[model samples]
Target chain A: MEPLTLDEKIRILTESARYDVSCSSSGSSRSNRKGGIGNAAASGICHSWSADGRCVSLLKILLTNHCIYDCAYCLNRRSNDIRRVALTPDEVAELTINFYRRNYIEGLFLSTGVVRTPDYTMELLIETVRKLREEHRFNGYIHLKLVPGADPLLVERAGRLVDRVSINLELPTRESLALLAPDKSREAILLPMRQVSGLITARRDEGRRAPPFVPAGQSTQVIIGASPESDLRIMTISEQLYQRMGLKRVYYSAYVPVTGDTRLPALNSLPLLLREHRLYQADWLLRFYGFTAYELLEADAPNLDPELDPKTGWALRHRQLFPVEVNRAEYEVLLRVPGIGVRSAKRIVRSRRVQRLRLEELARLGVVMKRARYFLTADGMTSGEADLSSERLKALLLPEKKKRSGPEQLSLFPTNDSDLSALTGEL
Target chain B: MAIWRYDGSFTGFLTLCAALLSQGEEPEEIISAEPLQNDLFRTIISVASDENRGEKMLAAIASRISPDSCRLLWQAFLSEAPGVELLLWRYLSFGRTTGVKCDRFLAHPAVGPVHRLANSVGQEAHRLMGIIRFQETAGGQWYALVEPAYQVLELIAPHFAARCSDMNWLIHDRRRSLAVAWNKQEWRLTRFDAQGVPPLSADEKAWSTIWRGYFAAIAIPERANLRLQQQHLPHRFRKYLTELEKPPRR
Candidate 1:
């Protein structure tokens, strides 16, 4: 009701931010000292790219946590029992300035509720960021939350100011949106995300002479497990986001329910952290690992194998593709093997010039031997062990991995991996 | 075998590498005799402070040997090993007649001993880069305390000047008893054996608060690989910071 105090605002904003997956990187948690002002060493690592391209960390916090809508999966949703607070533009700016001056953080992460109206709340956020940048001359990195349903004018203005803007697509599907989060619509979220994406594209095409709009680009969050979509659908949703939406990152936050709503699935209250971790891995595969969502999923096979990573699982299912000769394999073929990353592929390419590249050379270049050995023939040698069958290899490779950790957890294709893939009503 | 002593500098070592690698009666006897005993058990020859001869020697090695091969000798010389001058002499002598290329030494049986010596120098160079903690001085000059493993003060000065371009910084490696100073535009090295550094007034409390909050906030418990985190940012380095003091996550 009343504008909350600074502490109350921090509590509300930070609690509300808990459901938002992007900020897990401020740092790990730590115990507070009796007289200390803040804690930087606890249990996390928030790294940032310094002006010199060094990834450093800065305190990441929200200005307020109170929300207007009743998002089923959000901790800051209207009905959650959380303390509420809101720091003034000056207070937020000062805290950031104080922390930055002391090298406490790389920058600030400011998010807010749709307080009263979307534009009104967005303005409060912009004012805080504007004052911080213009008046205070705070030049470190800043990640601003571009509130969904906010005015396009406000979203564009905010996009031009912040390093990164994230408009969360809280639920994966429109049907799920109606069933679980009744207030939020598909267009309401996509419109703002599209606006920000377009703004970034326009600025880039114009060759922005000055600082770029959203230099780090736009990222969105999807609350996994809150809806009824499978992993295949989830990854498809992710694929379209990257290919069509032109999003930089689509963060998957496993649904952790805060309120008991019969309509909402009961299992989602705890952070589906493992699933979230898996989705991030899968997302990386699509973006950097050169993996396609179609390759990651089959028509009827719905989920990623929880036992092995998507890449490893892919290799296992397609055993006929094994023993790729490292000395002669193309970069594309090298990428198909389970354990070789981009760096290793480059290293493999580099080493081939200097030497004929025996099995020992790949190990020297940092290829994980346990997984890679089955898939690669170093020099001219494949496995001397003929008994190294696909099933036997999986048994040996993942002896401790008798249980799989994620299939749905890894939303391989953000826009297409889940329900959106099914209804690609467009595709 | 013979030893050729140096004035403890990389260029001086490069000079030594050049002279030994030259083809004549074979200077396979190069080694150091700087009050330290020679491991190679070679004849010791302390070349006089003749800049011209040193330059001539370096130029010769750079010419006869591959520029890359000469560079490896230069690395060995900077290591300040008692017999690097001798080993480079041996390697060069071997290269002259037998064609022992530089790449061979990188994975050579004899290169292990040479690398162990060269690594001592490189480790210091890397340590000075990371562990040389800087402090804001009263006179606007930033003072850093560095306890490097080797005599790497001369090696790291130019880097500081370029990285902290606007500031005048002084890095004093107390153990090596030398210091590097940057005067905004250029860097200069000097001998500095200050008895003890003034106690650093790092805002331990403020840094701790910030570090704790930072460490806690960044780690995704779902993704907190303690083993991986420890590997990247070790536990030993955590004691001085704000965050590592916290207990492990259960």
Candidate 2:
């Protein structure tokens, strides 16, 4: 294969990388300077704090776009007509170091399709990362993709070198795997994820502080709408992954139908971006917002409300829980408030230790009072005539027209709570 | 109204804050000026900066606001944000009556400006954190240059210290004319002339070879949203970036 120009490789790998949603870079010890190695700031990476509170944002990319597998939802599927390019191990390493040098990227997010075999592809990724860390002494954020069905030793060695590792589950169930992605199976992906998670767990318990294996931790991506699964089913699988398997993130990518396979749904062209978005919101509630999957997808609300966010919808449905006292609400009660995020709730709890806060004080503590005001009572004052019935509360909260007419920001992944500009611009 | 004035610099501001604590007065008035030439006929007690008084005052005011202000206030002031000084003073005064506060200022319209400024500081720190490209140095160390809008030297250094804990690294911010260097397990901030930044590693060819290769390998072509990429990773930032190695088209 001919070597790709910088423009060509960027086109290929960035497109390939787009399907993965983990780009948070926070919580690490930061000390970016005037002119040193790396800046963990606007110059290098603008971090989006993830659900687990870990921050990551390497130059997330894949080594090649030439995939042998025909994952029906992916553009890189072998059946799809796309210009194919692959970077050599040296090319991958060189590009990462170059990106690292210019302060364009914090680290390398290197994933690749199976060029020949799982081992061959895995070996290339391992060597590329090894060369960067050992030969180039590139001590920065490196998240290597764990190819499903790669050698166990290769997977283990990858864990040792990179800051994080991800083996995407692509779809939820084996049935969906069989239907949409003929080349992929749940076993191939979950086996490696379970392996990496087990190793990460083992190293943590050693207590010797062995260079934290996957310090930023393991994450996976699941393409939404490719299979016939409900939000309940999708979240149920994600909940198990978080609790039973101990994964860092389970990215939900709205299926952008690039392939026309008879096995997949025709509606995939529009994909379920909103559904994927809602799932991410529900996922945030599950992880950091302390929501359970069953609770998020209640009996009446089987799927998320595409119009209102899951949290907002939950607040509307559970009107009986309105006007929870903010100054003295339990952490659980505080978490239930829409717009009062995990960070904001923690801030409210911590700040109360100083003084009994007023409704105005809630805003000062980072609460989006515009949304939270309808749901909470701060210092015995609520945003209502003490008599506005639950019906009126819903009307006040709903308003005849929506606040803004754009699609809701990603409420699902990392339950993204940054300025909406970060979501609409980056994604 | 006691206006405690100091030289127009962070150190000078801290120096005055330290002096204000000595009078045991909640200096309702704080101002930053570069030795304003005014011969006042009225009584103005020239507050002498006692050594211990200065350190204690500096700690008292700084400890109450945010370590982030050490990196943000100057930019906030430079932006000429209304009431930043007053808000910082207000925050300090109230923070004196505090327990785990600072996030509280996020919604305060008065302190809102400062909180917004801190958000920018965090944004800058994280942008540099992600965008900072590291070039390999001849001495087996990683080197990169940054040009943040503000003096964020103290804001983002520890990230590298923790991730690349063993290696020696430096991020030189050309805009602020400052640098953060991590060597022997410690990070130090120092001033440098931005105009005189030495050329990147006199012989820089071999260092970025592997890096350039890594950059070339990872991009997915079928999904090229250059408009979107340009929005977050703009073209103006390409000069020092290795992945964005080639000069962007005008």
Candidate 3:
């Protein structure tokens, strides 16, 4: 067998990596030193956006597509007869630096299929990043994928060099992991996550002068709609990860079927994008809006409303919370309103302190009054003809179907008519 | 009513702002001398650019308003919005009277426009950080050309400087004819001539092709949303982006 060229290697590795959707390149502020080639911004920069609307924040690629374990849903599963290729540590480092120099990426997002052994793959990944940081003096943001069941010391060394490290919880539950990924165990994945989390906290507690261990913290991805897990279960796990594991983000990747396995859903099944999107919205609420999992979902109501956003759905379920006076309501109370996000709520709190705020004033403060009008009042005036009943309000608040255009057609290149809000996940 | 006209530079605008404040009379409008406009009834006053007065005015605003407010004022000036000068004057006057607290008054006639303008400029600068692509020139210097909706060259230069400290790079704002050049240490802004850009080397061209290939390959056809792509990266920013550029005819 001939050794694959660099282009062939990139094609195979990137093709394998495209399914993992944790493209965020934020949360670290690694500045460039005198001789270093790159730096990381506190607020991450998105170098580009793929046609899928996912951010192209980093040079996202895999170290190799060869695997020792076969995960049923993964593109690079061992059972699959796909062409396998691996780049040497030098190749990886050189590619990252060259790409960084050209401003083609913020940094490298290096994940891999388990090759030979978990520790071996982990060591290879560590060497690639280690070379970038030590040999090349590259101070750019690196999001390394910590191979499950790798050595703790290897995890520590990798954590120190990279800005972030993530281990994909591929499936939501242990049962699903056993069913879909016979080679991986629930404990194998969580152990490294726990270690990374513990190291990050210990480093923080040791003070700023202490050596950084994953300064951006750890994040994980869960494949949505792959296993038969409810949205409630997913959010509950996410909430736990946030509270107990100290994870920065829990990315939900909509499952795109790559195989015709008897156990998996058919290839034609919709990617559950709306569900993934709703989960992201709910995740945002949990992380930023002070909403708990219980507040968002109950045992009986397992999934988020497909038609309405999670916040608006939650607002409808608890109608008593509505009609909060924007002028007099507390900051927390204002944040609960369907239309008011974190920014708008803070704006309202600050702006109202200067003078009494009227309904018109809320619009200027970036509040989406179109949605907020039903739940908020200003200057003792309700948004005029408010529908207090939950059903009626839900009906009124639901986005009109006619307003939604047809399925977006893929363009070879960006068109002038491309909708910006749709692309940036502003939705 | 008097309309004050000054050179379009930020310093010139600040100088006029200080002059108007000293006179203790509000002007009907503040206009830049370039793209000069006329009003039949209003008296037009040509305010000479004064660096010291401008610095003093900026410092006074910084002292009264927050430093962040001064930054916002600068961003609004970069927005190049119609009647932005008048908006800044009104916002500065409000700031002088109310101090930094004036920022919270979102609904104030003067504050709203300035806030929106600054926000737009800031947003554009943030977007350009990702969309701007550099191609390697014959001399191995990285060169990227952009024509952002706002004057954000200064806003984005520091970011590139910090990220690409090892390489000499030049970012040209084609629309403004301004270029920011970083010489592996510090950066300086100068007038740019587009013709001076050297052609790409064969290796550079091949790397760009590979990059474009990667970009094309990574996009999931099942979830291709051109609308979303356009939203995150507008058409204006895509002109120089290698991935978005059309492939050369065979």
Candidate 3 local lDDT, B96-183, one digit each (tens): 8899798988877888888878877877887787777888888878888888998999999998888788788999998899999999
Indicate which candidate wins on TM-score.
3
Cα lDDT of model 1 by residue, A344-400, tens digit: 787677657545777765665657777788888887796576346777877876636
- lDDT string for model 2 (A1-427, tens) is 5775665666567667655766654322223333333323222344222221222356667788888788777778887887787777787777666555545456667888777878888999999988876776666667788888899999999988877788888888888888777787788888888888889789978886456577767888887777777899889999999998887678887665566677777663222655766777788789888888888786665778766778887887787877799888899899999879877888778767655778877876778877788888988988676456766666666625745564333223333254432442122
TM-score of chain A of each: 0.83, 0.85, 0.94
Best by DockQ: 3
**Which is better, 1 or 2, measured by TM-score?**
2
Residue A324, model 3: lDDT of 90
> DockQ: which is higher, 2 or 3?
3
The DockQ-based order of candidates, best leading, equals: 3, 2, 1
Question: Better model by lDDT, 1 or 3?
Answer: 3
Model 2's chain B yields a TM-score of 0.70
DockQ of candidate model 1? 0.11
